[model samples]
Target: MGANDIFGVPGDYNLQFLDHITHRQDLKWTGNANELNASYMADGYAREKGFAAFVTTFGVGELSAINGLAGSIAEHVPVLEIVGAPTNNVQNNGSLVHHTFGDHKFDRFEKAHRQLGIKSARLDGEHAIDQINDVAQYIYETKKPAYIILPTNLVEMEVNKSLKDSIPNLFFNKEMNSENSFEQIKSSINNIENPVIVMGHEVDRFNVFNDIKSFSSNNNIPVLDLGLGKGNIDESFSNFVGTYNGQISDESVNKYVANADTVVLIGAKLTDSVTGGFTQQFNEQNTIVLNYENANIYGKSVDKDYNFKTIMTYLSKTKLDLSLPSIKNADNVSEIKPSNNKLTQSFYDKAISQFTSADNTIVAEQGTSFFGLASQKLPKGAKFFGQPLWGSIGYAFPAALGNQIANKNRRIVLSTGEGSLQLTIQELGLAFREKLNPVMFVIDNSGYTVERVIHGMNEPYNDVPNLNYKLMPKAFGAKEDEYDFIEASTENELFDAIFKAKEEKDKLVLIQVNMEMKDVPEQLAKTAKAFADQNK
Candidate 1:
């Protein structure tokens, strides 16, 4: 309900609906080059602005954007996907449409989307208002994506103006009977000697950063964030440890988490990527897990109404053993003395770590970009965006566009591999059209570096045709003075390019950093080995 912008590509079926969006003075319509990028932009906007929507035509358009919608679902982002369908009579009579399968069947797309979305609804003129309100409420409460099919004939259908006043409140009502669950959690905490708090993506999804900080700081407990939960907490906190990625974590972080007597996991999902190929060794019987809707203590389930925030509030007052061990910060980048002077992952990591600040936002792509930035430190108040669970490449490009739109005052730095950027590179034109300035670095590794490490080392399938990345800005309609394009093949060139980009604040800067195909992040190499073994 609080969404400020809509992203989509205009189509014949969706034109009428888009016209209304353009007429609204309070809302902005971001027209992307393609539907996939549009959905990704909406996903990024939702992650930053709390709520976002994207519109697309039925069938082809909806299917094209399905991958982005799937990413939002996997990551628990609240996005409303509006699909513009044919007229009511056309659907009622099963008439063939351009985007249809030519069998007069139009419901197949909605059926497929239901599996990926929290809920799917097709609006009917007679009950459109009721259906819209129900779906909106569900999306707000669950913080998940939802699909809505808007028939072309219903675009101009008028309804009671008072329906807008009936939108339900989005907050969850505190349960009075949660005291029993609180007592169980307190007993579990009291039984443990060294308990550590682990933060996850849900902590940011529910907007409870302050609550977690208060609880961890007041209790003097050490806090550790998972890979996906990067930038969700203030890393500068005295008790805040670095990210814990099971086997891939730093020696100090792994020791603190692995040896703890009791682990308090808050809003965390131990996915394979985040857990170093499912290498975590914690005992569920000694863990207290708190999520959005429920809590579990030492393998015992709490009441369904016992939310994470309420449990954190209770734990703030309850005293547990404060004998937890302090953890030192992990040095993500190792000092490298190159023998041949070829660009390496260490140089890229250090350069990005130096460029990032509290006023910036970093968007990393799925493969090397995601794994490489896992250990990089961010300044306080900085935001990080990535698709770890979905593992979607080319997501960060358009997502960076959306993030910039949502937070226009902050600078955006996007790190993506060349292989990943090719999928959604058309969004660069949209960035030019919108006059948004984001410093984008394309890691020209020659191919899919992460895939090469996983199963295709020296394989032809992992290779991609290299393109002249510096010419892309001009091709995207950027004036010579409106953008800066550079190629960095050495450490000094990379450093100078980034420094120059920072000085040119008013224009978008595109930097192509060249690296060897085998130059992969250390953590990604280990994770890839595990994946290769598992697949074997």
Candidate 2:
């Protein structure tokens, strides 16, 4: 509801609504390349900001956007999906629309949305305002995607303003009676000798990111952020430990976490990707989970449901033995020297670590870009976003575009592969047209290296077409002073690109880094081997 900008694509059905958007002086419209990328941009905007609005035409456009909306809801992001449908007369007469199937099924698309667990409502002139308020409240309560079907005829529907607007806001918004839940957590945690906190994604979604930092630092609890919640906490904190992704984590981290007497899992998702194919050693009996729907206090159920922020606030005040056994620091990972002749995944990983800082917000694609940078130690205030669970490629770049709009002060660093970039390369024009400055790295590894690492080495299915990436800037209509492009195949050239990108802060710098097709990051290699083993 607090959207300053809306991301969308115009279609025949949505033309009238686009006209309204064009006249709005308070809001800016971000016309994306397609509906899917538009949805992805909205998802990223919601992740950076509190809420987001995405518009698309019904049927074709809405179906195209389903995947991105599904990812947002799976990751617990609040996005208001607005669909411009046909006129009420057409829908009522069961007229087959141009975007729909040949059969007279007007509700098929909305039915598809329901399968993805999205709450949806179709509006009419009589109940337009009521439906809008209800859906808005639902999105506010649950950090998930909500759907609104606005018929073309109802776009100009006249309705009385809400009488409830005159009333105070506090009467409508009330927190649950978490006093008993707080007492339960406080009592159960007092007996804990060695407590370990595992930061999860919901912490940021609830706007209580600083609360976890306060709780961890005040109680001297060693923090291990999961892969889904990467950059959720300050990596430079004294109490901060490395990311714990089951067997893929460092030996010291696995050992320390295994030896912990009590594990506090706050808003964490122990999914396959986050837990390295469910390799986590900890059991439910010794784990304390604090989430929105599920908040179990070490196998003991609370009186009722408690939110993450409230649970964390109470857990921080509980007494625990802060002076526990000393935790061992992980061994240093050797950085590849930039003096090397060729650029390797390990060197790129090191370069990513070097390029990161407090002023940066890094978005890595789901392939090698994510695997290589997942384990890197970010600066104290740097933010990271990826689609680990969704595993969607081509999501980072457009998402970075929306993120830049949300916070213009922070620099957005985008790392993506060539194969993935080809999916939404048209959106590159939107970034250039908006005059946004994002340092984008397009890795040209010849093909889908991540898929090859898993299976089918040398298969043609994984190969991608190669093109001169340097010409991309001019193709996107970028002006000479507004953009720069570099192709880096060697270590020296890569460093040159990085230095120039950082130096030219106002220009949108795109660096194309070439590597061997067989090359893979250390973390990705091991994980892929295990995946290949399962298929065998």
What TM-score, computed on C-alpha atoms, does each candidate reach? 0.95, 0.95
Pairs of residues at least 3 apart in sequence or in different chains that clash in candidate 2: none
Model 2 lDDT tens row, 58-131: 88899899999999988888999899999989988889669988687788888888988999999988777768
Error of 2 at 108 (Å): 1.0
Model 1 bad stretches (over 4 Å) = 168-177, 316-318, 321-340
Error of 2 at 119 (Å): 1.0
Each candidate's lDDT (Cα)? 0.83, 0.83
- Candidate 2: regions farther than 4 A off: 161-173, 298-300, 321-337, 534-536
> How many clashes in each structure?
0, 0
Worst 10 residues of 2 by lDDT: 166-175
Q: After superposition, how far is residue 446 of candidate 1 from its true place, in Å?
A: 1.2
- Each candidate: RMSD: 2.2, 2.2
